[model samples]
Target: MNPFVDIILRSCTVYFFMVLALRVFGKRELSQLNSADIVLILLISNSVQNAMVGSNTSLEGGILAALALFVINYLFKRWINQSKTVKDWVLSKPQVLIHNGNVEFKTLAKLGITSEELDEAIREHGVESHKNVKLAMFEIDGNISIISGDNNLKQTHHKRKIHKTLNEL
Candidate 1:
């Protein structure tokens, strides 16, 4: 086979494998990337590169692989949008990890997350403590959504104070 044809074939194979892997791994939103998720993405890209370029070191091989990946991803996204079942399965439903200031230990364990991680997530949302959170959910995309109790009003007040100071300045 000509080097060009070999490159194209390798690219197609890698693109197909990527599509299959993505289907198997389930879909998650980009904003929801956690540490583990990021590592998985990196590993997948590195592992698939050789499969995509084969033994060809030409620029055309790399370009072919990249283009193939783009096309496959575009088609997958289109299909996911049109199919409800596929959407649901690919995008997992949110799981409640904490409720009414109490951590759901079972759920946490199942998600392979620690209470400390949960606490950090809550804090990132500006909640002082878990007690201030009314609801905390682990989104399918690996993000934590925190719904604060009336304590959010306190945060609002703090924000207002800062704005007022800035305005005066």
Candidate 2:
């Protein structure tokens, strides 16, 4: 087997494994990164580096591995866009956390989100309380989306604020 081809295969395998692990373990923790999450990311990257490069310590090997990972990710995205079934299997549906000022406790619990987190997201959007929130959705990308309004007033107040610059939710 060619060294570059081996690097490409190894990188692709690692990428798929990481994606599957995150998909199965729940993506909630990824929304809000704490100290532990950062540490976990650092450690995982360091550990996976060896698995991707194997015995090839050359700069070319490292570049090939990285390029392979990028290409695999690009292809995966394209596949998801082209296939509805693939998209559905690879991604979860957006969850409705609050509707008509009513918090869906079951959905929140299922998503491993606390009432406090929901409330915080609402407040971040400038909603005074749950009653002010017309709709609150936990998006598939892992961000809380809140739309505030008063039915009596016949108004809509939808606001979104990014907690951090994230590559993905």
> What is the Å distance of residue 18 in model 1 from its true position?
3.9
- Would you list the clashing residue pairs of candidate 2? none
Query: What's the C-alpha lDDT at position 131 in model 2?
Result: 86
Please give each candidate's TM-score: 0.68, 0.83
Candidate 1 global CA lDDT score: 0.71
Tens digits of lDDT, candidate 1, 1-169: 7776666677767776765677686555665455667899999888878877877767877887677777767887798899998777665678897789998899988766667677667766788888877888877656777888865343311100112343365
The residue-level lDDT of candidate 1 at 66 comes to 76
Stretch of 10 with least lDDT, candidate 2: 154-163
Candidate 1 segments exceeding 4 Å error: 1-12, 19-44, 151-169
Q: After best superposition, candidate 2 residue 119: deviation in angstroms?
A: 1.4
lDDT of 2 by residue, 4-84 (tens): 999999999999999888788755445466656789889999999999999999999999999999999999999999999
lDDT of 2 at 97: 87
